[model samples]
Target: MALEQLSALKYGKKTDLSAKLMNIHTKLRRYAAVHSGHANMQTTLCALAVDEDERAFAVNVGDSRMYRCRGGCIRQLSTDQSLVQMLYEQGRITADEKKTHAQKNVIFPVLGNASEEPQPCITEIIGGVQRGDIIIICSDGLSDYITQGEFEEILALPMRLPRRIAKLAEAAIKNGSPDNVSVVGVSMV
Candidate 1:
């Protein structure tokens, strides 16, 4: 339902995307609060949008992610909202420990209600989206299983956008993904 609302909007500039995302979250939060048995229900989102000048912006909430492949390397464009990620960022935990943390799956900056939980979602401007760059928006199921090197390897192949998405999703499941996998890919031509 949140995804459906996001798909219908226009995106441009940092403020535009920020306000739109917040509005969507606000509306969805109200709906879920009144109708849902689970008051804390939340979901993740990862999106890439292009403006009239062709500038790209990435926005995300929860643990979903957006990645940009440029100059032969893939970079994560979105930050995770999980507690494990926060601990690692603050130097309280190591990279390996982030994976093994007891609350590894506790995600934050949730879309449900920011008033109840005070974490702001992240938004980033994707600089210099070039002809050969690739952008991928995906769920954790895909992001967790696809390593940096493997992503580079698969994306280096001479395949169309749809085929690349297919292979990536397939690889995630083959790698024993514990949750649903979804991927959207675009190779900037």
Candidate 2:
């Protein structure tokens, strides 16, 4: 349903990326309510879109994530909407505590939340990816097991994007990730 909503993006004149994501969010909420029948359907999303000029835009909800790596450094581009994240923000838990927290997987904002519609965190890159820059979009399954440093190490390696993604998935599994891992990687031309 979200995909259906987003498919219209390239049809018309270019629109503000954030506004387009907000429209998708609203559509997803409506779609969920109509189809779920009160069974509490939900799903997280993390996606990055890069324009012809390399300008980047991203939208995130729940525990899915987006990251950008450049020049041997990697940084998280989206904030998690999970309980542990809330605790961390409120000074109730240390940063390390979040990793081992009892409720690290509890996320409130998602693509399909009937109780409360999600508000996607929309981010715009002032000047997007350059040559050698890497953009990663992944589910919690991948993000939970991969470290920022590890992401930098793998993405910066002298390999193709597909190989880098394979290495990331392998690393996640090697690190004992118990959830499904999904990874998408983009490198500038």
**Each candidate: how many clashes?**
0, 0
TM-score for every candidate vs. truth? 0.86, 0.83
Residue 118 of model 1 has an lDDT of 27
- For residues 108-189, could you state the per-residue lDDT of candidate 2 as single tens digits? 8676666676777777765666887788889888888988888888887787889999999999999999999998888766
Q: What global local distance difference test value does model 1 have?
A: 0.79
For model 1, give the 10-residue run with minimal summed lDDT.
114-123
For candidate 1, lDDT tens digit of each residue in 1-189?
778888888665544666677777788788877886766667777777777777666767788888899987999888888899989999999988976689988887666664654254545465857898888889888988878888988888787778878999999999889988988888889
Misplaced by over 4 Å in model 1 are: 34-41, 114-120
lDDT of each: 0.79, 0.79
Per-candidate RMSD, Å: 2.4, 2.9
Off by over 4 Å in 2: 11-19, 22-39, 50-55
Q: What would the TM-score be for candidate 2 when compared with the true structure? A: 0.83
